[model samples]
Target: MEMENMIGLTDLLAAAIRAWKQICVTMLVFALLLGGYQGYRQYKLATDPENSPEKIEERYQAALEDYEKRGEELQKKLEGQEESLASKEEYREESLLIKIDPYNKYITNIVFSFSNIDESAQLFRYPNTAADYLPKKIRSQYLELWKSMDVPRDLADGRYADLEWKYLNELISIPALEGELLSIRTMGASAKDAEDLAGAIFAYFDGHRDAIGRSSAAHELSILNQSTKYVIDEELKTKQESLDKEIEDLKTGIEDTKQSIEDLTEPEREDGYSVTAIVKSVAKYVALGAAGGLFLACFLVCCWWIFADRAANSFQLERSVGAPFLGAMKPSCPPAERLAAAVMGERRWRDPEQASAYIREQAEAGFPKEGKVLLLSTLPEGKAGAGMAGLASALEGYAVTSVLDALHDPKAVKAIQDCAAAVFVEMAGQSRLTDIRDLAAQVEGAKRPVLGVIAI
Candidate 1:
C-alpha cells in the first residue's frame, strides 16, 4: 500500500481538521449542553441554603450566643461559691472532690523531684526529657488501667479505651514548667483522671521517698539546717496567708475575663467556601466541559473519517489511485458552470495557465501532435465536459472531440478510435478511484490506453 493509503500523518491531520469542520454543529450543541449544566450547577450551589453566606453568618451568630450562655452558667457557678475565710476551707475540701469522681479510674501518672533536694547535684531535666525517660511499661499502663476502670476493652472498636489511649498518646504533650518546686503531677484520658493520677503518683513517690532521700544524702544532706528551715517555713507561711484573699480575687477576675473574652469573640469558619471561589470553580468546570465536548466531537468525527474509504483532500485522492492530481474543485463552487468558472472568475469556462499546463503535460506524455484529434471522455457522464472543453481549447494545434456518457455507452468506442488518443476528465473529490479504474479497463479493452487524467 502507498504511504497515503496507510494513513500518513499529514493525511490524518487534514482529515481530522475536516472532520471537526464537518461535525462543528454537533460539537457546538454538545458544548452548549455542557455549559448549561455547569451554569445550573453553579446556580444551585449559589442558591443552596447550606452554602449561603447569610445562613452561615446566622449559624455563627447562633453558636456565639450559645457559647455566651454557657459562659454565663459557669459565672453563676463561680459566684455561688463563697470566698469568705469560713468558706475557704470548704472550697478547698470541694476541690478535692476528684476522690469520688468516677472518671478518675482512667488516670495514669509520673512524679519527678522538681527541686534539687541534693544541693550539690542537678535534679530532673526538662519535662520533655523526663517524659522521654518514663518507662515503656508505664506508658503502656493506660490500657491495663482503663481495663480495670470497667471501660470497654474491645480494642478493635475505635470508641474503646484502648483505641482512645492509642490516639491520645499522639495528642498528649508534656507541659513545660518554671522555677524550682517539689511537684507531683499526673495526666490521663480526662481532667478527673489527671487529678486522681496526681494523688496516686504522690502516694507512689512518697512510698519511695526514704529510699530516694537516703540516696540523695549520700551526695549531700538534703535537709536544711534547723534554724534556716524554721525561718524560711515561717516566712513562706506568712506570705501565703497574706496573699490568700488577693489570690482568690485574681483567680475570680482571670476566670471572668477569660469567659467574657471567649463569649465576645466570633470564631471564623475557615472551612466554608466563598461565593467568588465557587463561581470561579464553576467557570473552570464549564470551560473544561466545553473543551472536552468539542474534543470528543472532533475525535469521533476523525475516527469515522479515517475508517470510511473516502477522499478528504486532493492528496488522498491522488495517492489512493496512484495518479497525478491536476487540481481540486472547491465545494462552494456551483456544479452548473462545470466548477471551472469559480476558479477562472468571469472568464467563460476556461483557465489559460491551468489549461496550458494541462495540455503541455499531456503532449509530453505522448499525446498526438498538431492537427490530430484528442477525444475527451469522462466516467459516469458529462459533469466535467465544460472543464474538458476549456482544456481542449488550450491544446495548441490539436483539435479536441468529446464523447458524453462515454463509459456507459458502447457507441462511444467508435469516437475514441476516431481520435488520436483519449484523456479522462474527473471531478475531484466527487469521483471514485474504482470507477476510474473500470473506465481505464474499458478504454484498454478498446485498444486505447488512457493518456492521463485531469482532476478539477
Candidate 2:
C-alpha cells in the first residue's frame, strides 16, 4: 500500500514539472490579487488620523514620560511616610507603652529561644532536629500556615515549610543563660488572635516539658517557673488608645499618597496594532506571498508534468503502445524535410538512403509480392498526404496504392483488400492514443497485417 501511494505521488510530481510555466503564471496572478486587497486595508488605516502610527507613538511617549515623573514622586512620598511612622514622638511612646501592656504583648513581637538544641546533632544531620520532632498536632498547625499561603502540600523536601520554620527561627533567640530553655512566641493581627496563638504555642511546650529529654528536664522546669515574665502595666494600656489613633491617621495619609500615584500612572491602552506595526506586518505577508507563490508554482508544475499524456521519449512511446520501436525521428527535424519525406512515402523510415532498400526488402515478405501495397498515415491532412506520397515514391519498384484518408473512410477496408500489405505512420508525441487504437482496429477489421508503427 505504501509503495503504491509513493508511486502515485511520484507521478503527480512529474506532471507538475511538465506544466511549470502555466502554473507559475497562474499563481503570480492570484498572489497579486490578494496583495491588492491587503494593500487597500493598509491604505485606509494609514489615512486615519486618530489611529495612525505617528499619533499613537506620540501619545505613548507622552504617557511614558508622565508615568516616570510620577513614579519618582510616589517613591519620595512613600519614603517620607515611612520616616514619619518611625520617628514620630507618639510612635516611639506607643512602642514603649506596648512593651508593658498586658494585651499589647500578645500582638507584639514574641521570641523563642532554644539552648543546647544542637548539642547532640551529627555532622550530616540538620542542626535543629527539635523542630522536626515536634508533636503531630503542633507540626500540623505549623504546616497549615504554609498551606494557607498556597504552598504545595506534596513537596517532599518541604522547601516552603522549611522557609516558614526559618521565619519562626528569626522570631527566636537564645540567651547565654546557665540553663537549658525553650521559648516560643507568636503574634497575629489583633490582641485576641495573637494571645490565642502565643498561648497555644507556649502550652505545647509547657505540656511537653517532660518530653524535652531527661537530661534537660531540670533546666526546663526552672525556665517554666519564671511567672513574673507575664506581668502587665495598666498605665501603658490606657495610653495605647491615643497612640493607635495617631498611627491610623499616618496610615491614612500614606494610603492617600498611594492612591494619587496610582491615579497618575494607570495605563492608557490603544486598541489594535500600531500603524507602523501594521505596515511591517503587511510587508511580511508580501514577502511570504512571493515565497509561497514560488513554491505553489513549482508544485503545480510538477503535477502537470507527471500526468501529461504525451510520450516524453522513444522508450515511453514503445511502452505505452505495446509496440516494438523500429525507429524515431528527431523533433528538431525541419518541417520542410518532414514534409518532403512525407511526400515521398518514406515518413516511416528515418534515413533517406535506407527507404528504398527497406521497401525492396519487405516487398516480398507479405502477400502479392509483385502487386500494389497500401501506405497509410495516422496523421491528419497535409502531414498524412505528404507521407502517403513519399511512401508511393519509395515503393516505385511495385505498384503502390496510397490512402491518406483511410482512417475514417467507409471504403478503407475495400481499398486495403486490393493491396497486399499496409504500413502505419504516426508522430510520436503529437498523435492521440485513442486515434491510433481506432486506426489499428480498422486495419485489423480489413484482415490486413499492420507492417509496423513508424515513430516520427
- Per-candidate TM-scores read 0.41, 0.38
- Strongest candidate by lDDT: 2
- RMSD to the hidden true structure, all candidates: 21.3, 20.1
Off-target runs (Cα >4 Å) in candidate 1 are 1-4, 18-20, 54-286, 311-355, 369-389, 402-420
* RMSD, candidate 1, Å: 21.3
lDDT per residue, candidate 2, 85-137, as tens digits? 76665444533234444454433333333433333433354666554343322
Clashing pairs in 1: none
Model 1 scores worst on lDDT over the 10 consecutive residues at 223-232
lDDT of 1: 0.49
Clashes of 1: 0
* Residue lDDT tens for model 1, 260-289: 756665556534455676666666766676
Deviation from native of the Cα of residue 369 in model 2, angstroms: 3.8
